[model samples]
Target: MEELEAELAQLSGKLELARESLKRLRITRETVTEVLAEMEPEMPVVAVDAGPPRSGERVVSAYAGAERRVIGVLTVPNWQPGMMPDVLPSAYRDIVEVVADAPGPIRAKQIVPRIGLPAETGKIEGTRAKLKRLVERGWLDEEAPGLWACSPSSTACSGSCCG
Candidate 1:
């Protein structure tokens, strides 16, 4: 009986320690999230009345008997001859401009800080995702794995980075 009581006490102590550790971790996570939210710029919100539209489709809303097209802030439209970086979301435009201004190919990590984002892993990966999307849409080129540069055909790069 005494041995069982000692073991139970040990388990209780361990349980308390685990609870305390979990509480501390939760608090740390909350604080870090708050700090990050404050540090990051406010992203523009797009209100779509209907379900999410297919990529490259413009959202139209009828207001006062007139239809107005709304550009999605997160959409990356495929590049065309006359399409300019102005059509991209501000974040994407920033990345393109950074790449266009660079002397050669750059990595997401290098672009992150240049575009005013923290050089954290999450930021770098998010930037990499945008970079890949731009490549897919012909706004940028991937010379090799993880290396990004302005696409030669892109109007944003024609006279600047690619030249």
Candidate 2:
């Protein structure tokens, strides 16, 4: 009877220790999760700009099978309703002029050259703006941000794909 009582006492003590250990483990796990969560810092995100005021949404655009950052997105301004002319023809003529005159894809203010008209292609408004208009009218293609190229569409560059 004495030996049985001693064994029961030992088993009770072990059960109590196990319960305490389980409680401590739960508390430790909670503490670790909270600490890890607090370790991460929040990042700031700004909205999109219209003009040159650091505007525009942070849209992740895909280029050539890889993701790219959209540095800027400019909308077209002088688009007539009926005239709906081909955007690239006029712009292409101007780009050809500038390339024949002085060849360089240098930035002319906000307008990225080669993507549209050259900075010196015309003395009108912005070359980039013309490119945007052309893109809207299916004339040119903006392969990526700050990287515009003559579109490889059926109507635009017909020979390349069709032929």
Candidate 3:
């Protein structure tokens, strides 16, 4: 029992050190973003493949450190709504497409206008809802509140988008 307790204590100390390191590294959003741009101006892009989920394949989406719980059928490029009954909610699908096609981590403000409103992508309210939900679901990350981008470990997601 003493041995087990000692081992657990050592593990806890390591975890604390890792967490402290994170706190030290976290910085103002603006500064980190500028550094990223200076390092690589051309933002990377992510592509989702079209097919049924396969065993042990990465989760529908992955993020910072968690496997995004696959709550719905994932989306992929070239997916026509008619092809799958579970195509991503309309506006989100459009938003995803726009983000995927963009040269970089397009600002939400920029994309919403180009995709238009209350049509194929649905009303502004609907689009925003999808954006929020997708971010929560880990398909996207809240880079700057309203701004979003695919995560690093993302399976159907990728890129170094920040805004």
Tell me model 1's lDDT, rounded to 2 decimals: 0.75
- State the lDDT at 145 in candidate 2: 63
The numbered model that scores best in lDDT is: 1
Better of 1 and 3 by TM-score: 1
Alpha-carbon RMSD, candidate 2:
20.2
Q: List, residue by residue over 1-163, the lDDT tens digit for candidate 3.
A: 9999999999999999999886665443335434433542122212234455445333433223333323332333232212221235555656766765666565665676768753444455556676677666555566776666664444334432222
Deviation (Å) of 100 in candidate 3: 1.8
TM-score, cand. 3 vs. native: 0.37
Instruction: Give the Cα error of residue 154 in candidate 1, in Å.
Output: 1.0
Clashes of 1: 0
Expressed as tens digits, the lDDT of each residue in 73-108 for candidate 1 is 336777888767876788998999999888999999
CA lDDT, candidate 3, residue 27: 40
Best by TM-score: 1
Q: Each model's C-alpha lDDT?
A: 0.75, 0.43, 0.51
Instruction: Name the weakest run of 10 consecutive residues (lDDT summed) in model 2.
Output: 40-49
**Stretches of candidate 2 above 4 Å error?**
1-92, 96-125, 159-163
